[model samples]
Target: MARHTAFAAICVGICAAGATLGGCDRPAETAAPADVFLANVAEYCGKAFSGRVVANEPPADADPFADKNLVMHVRGCEQPSRELRIPFHVGDDRSRTWILSRTDSGLRLKHDHRHEDGSEDKVTIYGGDTVDSGSATRQEFPVDRESVALFQREGLKASVENTWAMEIHPGNIFAYELTRPGGRKFRVEFDLTEATELPPPPWGHE
Candidate 1:
């Protein structure tokens, strides 16, 4: 009976040791860089900021932002879903929503464009996921496979190599940037120090 008791004790010790070893071998998961950027953006929830096209002459096409009203409303923060749906108003069009989501690998930024009747545009949902964990205030997302395919289908071959970036300067500026290798660099910065009234619900959001 004493020998049997000793054997049982040894088995329990072995199991505990194995469990400890397994735990030590596993690395801990950390918050993604995109999530950090998203948190920074969330700080402006329920606020509206107006901006203008900083670039004198945007390349690749004629500037559609000339003398147009531009407003961005950060509203409806969904923490549980890890998504921040920020509506971007260009001129009289309120049909654009920038969807930021935290994925397993990184954060994804999708541009959701809708018509006046809430119908999705054929070229909507074209955005990319962060390829790396950038700084807390900034994250860059290169063209993802899905976005590339969409561009190809839409005959937008020039946009296949595009990359988008968002930067938050905390009380200074919040800028959205787009670059395509050596193609073009477009940026628009909102005034963080002076927030306007929240805009109405995006075209289809209501």
Candidate 2:
């Protein structure tokens, strides 16, 4: 069907490249499962949706849902490189963005926080990469070494074990979640059925 064609369009070239190399370092690159997954979410580009924190048992160092107006804007996509920039806004603060980029292994997710002056936050670019070929609608990223180092440098030792996830149940729901050491967990789910007008770009992104 057409959906399958789109999947092929996104996945085939990367796969063929792997074969040309005689084999790829990351075997998952052969099928490009994350490529299909990215393509699925890319369908929502330019739209914004509201969400609520469904799970939040915050630890002492954690602040969950301090802002009620939660919005996620699937703002940009570059099909050639397989990248997505989703700005996550909460109330009046436009400081957070979720950057997803394709990799030979799977996918990488980075939390890019910025100051009002468009400067990167001290703890920015901290996140993880997928360890497996996740499904077309879901993916999990375990904290990567670079993120651990960043957290340690920022005195956020507790977040070194962070694990983040994103899910899309086309036309139904889209969700983001975080889990870290010490049983801390936070989750927010967006209603994909109701698309709101796009909000302003996140700080440093405009």
Candidate 3:
């Protein structure tokens, strides 16, 4: 009888130990999905970047060089999922919105650009590519042909042909590169040490 009691106690202790270890591992397994999504968004939020713009050909009577400075913010995100709304301002007149999410098809990116007073720019929906390679997340977008033609008609052809690239480092560094028609390119790199959520844009609230 005593031998049987001792064996039962040993089994109970072993089971308890296993339960403790299993409990400890649960959080990690459940949290991994959200962690990965937030990590990518945190990489570029609240950062400032600077770069230049070169045109394929100088306008007949305009300057041939332009420079840009931009600040990026991760406005808000849906938890337990990979949906994010990122807003950015470039120089003084151009503001943009980027919607990012993880889809079965891969990471998806959509862009919307607006003028200083919140009017839609010549191009509204610009398509882009995104990749989350273990170390960093990167995106590249080219101006759409329809938007390019609109810009051309509006006398802003030089700006329409620029291709944009953005990269977010795991350490919260944001970098951008812009290339114009004639292979002229500009690059910017910045870090986001402070992240604070701001009020949503008017349209967003609606």
Candidate 4:
């Protein structure tokens, strides 16, 4: 009887250990679906997008493309916008390129300003608040202070307030817009139709 009881207790101990291990693994399995979806979105965004800046606020004084090309592409759209790159130009001059991504805390925006000779002017990173809008995600970063200095340094005499908006369409397009304090707005709509193949970044050079 003593031997039988001892055997039963050992069996119960083994079952308890198995149960504990199973419970520990459950959370990982439950999170897999979300991880997979985000991974897919990131993969899609990793492709370079070729599109024109269809609109702008305050309008460019001269031809928008006469200087250089203003094009945008996504590096990745996962939790981290890891390798996303955006380029802006002024008369054959690539003035600025922005690298940004999403994080658990919020959205991160990095600006790489360059001179005509391919020299780095300034590198700055800005963070903002992010919100999900179901079909699309919106990121709002305060520009009142940062814009004042950045715009001045960049030789753009624009006093902007309120927020900058970046909306992702999940598929092939991403839209960027800036809303100033006085209600003046600038928008860039990126259409991916002309994109033959997606390239990796630094503006995804073919």
Candidate 5:
């Protein structure tokens, strides 16, 4: 009887300590980086931001984006955490939409290019999947096999090895970047401090 009573008292003491220290309950698991990243970008749903080309190495003599207004509309967020569609507008051209979605392994990024008539471009839907667990504010995607085959078929062999990355600093800046071998670097940064007028939907989305 004495041993049982002592054991009961010890258990009671342990329980009291657990109650105070929260050690008895299992700790909540932290979200994976990919999930956190998706959630981070989803916060901008229904907003629009203006961007400018910040880096363009091997500058072209006739830059397509030069002096052109650039806008990114974060829309199509019915399933914000699962998928997001951001339309990238360059002046009068409204043919590009960036699709970000969560995959079983990690995340995926795809480009949807369309013609003015709403037809899919020949080299459309080409992008990549995240190869690792990027941070909550940034992710890198290497060109996938499917994209490589499409690029090869389209005679865009140089793009087969492309790597695309995105960075989001809440209330500060959102950046889109692309890099490849041979010193190719292109980046566009959007000011997240100011929300701009939402642009029209990309081709075929309207």
Candidate 6:
């Protein structure tokens, strides 16, 4: 009890001495769930991790990614805690990137696709925003009206109802998922415990 009291006294004296700077009694504001999730992912900025297809329904005999290496590079953290652009690399193809950013309401997720010549793909920048306060380790983004319109215009009726989700468990696994009606689902999980070599920047991001 005496040791505890002494520690408390010392803390109090320090606070009193720095009272002009700012009192230690200021109330702490708790970060929202979306913010926490973004921070959790930002912890892996500047690193690249290897991943594998964890789930892919309606399997195809000629899966394009079956024999290719899969990697995800967490980069473009220049926006500080506000945004991150993670490139999804499949072997030598660096055409896909996942852009996650903070929104006034919750969060936003978008897909950026580019050609080898650094040209933007026609059906690119289609994604959605979080509708609720998801947990710190996970967040789900349902197809928004804009993305739906884009898909419809591109004749991608099946993707109009797509819902994408991302999960990040520090030091364990980070997952990306896509689900839609008619039992369509795809998921890839990256091993966060080990970061692989940093790959080249996503196409158009160079």
lDDT tens per residue, model 3, 71-173: 4556554321345666655545335776665454344455777666677766665544433332224565566566577667778767687666666654456
TM-score of each: 0.80, 0.84, 0.51, 0.56, 0.86, 0.85
The sequence of per-residue lDDT tens digits that candidate 6 reaches over residues 9-121 is 43344355442213434221244667657767877789999999989897877887897899999899776356789999999999999999977778899999999999999
Residue 172 miss distance in model 4 (angstroms): 4.8
Error of 2 at 194 (Å): 1.4
Candidate 1 off by > 4 Å: 1-32, 56-61
lDDT of 4 by residue, 73-137 (tens): 45433223223455543324455566555344344455666555556665344323344322224
Candidate 1 C-alpha lDDT tens digits along 1-206: 43233223333432354422123222212333454466567777789999977753245356677778899888867551366888989888899898887676677889999999989999999899887778767888898899899999999998999998888877788988888865588888899999997777898899
Ranked by TM-score, top first? 5, 6, 2, 1, 4, 3
lDDT of 5 at 24: 26
| Candidate lDDT (C-alpha), each | 0.74, 0.80, 0.50, 0.47, 0.83, 0.82
Q: Better model by TM-score, 1 or 6?
A: 6
Model 5 residue 43 CA deviation in Å:
0.7
Model 2 lowest lDDT segment of ten: 19-28
The candidate 6 region of ten consecutive residues with least summed lDDT is: 19-28
- Candidate 1 matches the true fold with a TM-score of 0.80
- Scored by lDDT, model 6 comes in at 0.82
Query: Candidate 6: TM-score?
Result: 0.85
Task: Candidate 1: give its CA RMSD in angstroms.
Answer: 12.7
Candidate 3: deviation at residue 173, Å? 1.2
lDDT of 5 by residue, 82-174 (tens): 678999999999999999997876889999999999999999999999989888789999999999999999899899989999998777899
TM-score (C-alpha, index-matched) for candidate 3: 0.51
RMSD, every candidate, angstroms? 12.7, 4.1, 13.3, 13.4, 12.5, 8.3
Q: What is the lDDT of residue 179 in candidate 2?
A: 90
Q: Global lDDT for candidate 5?
A: 0.83
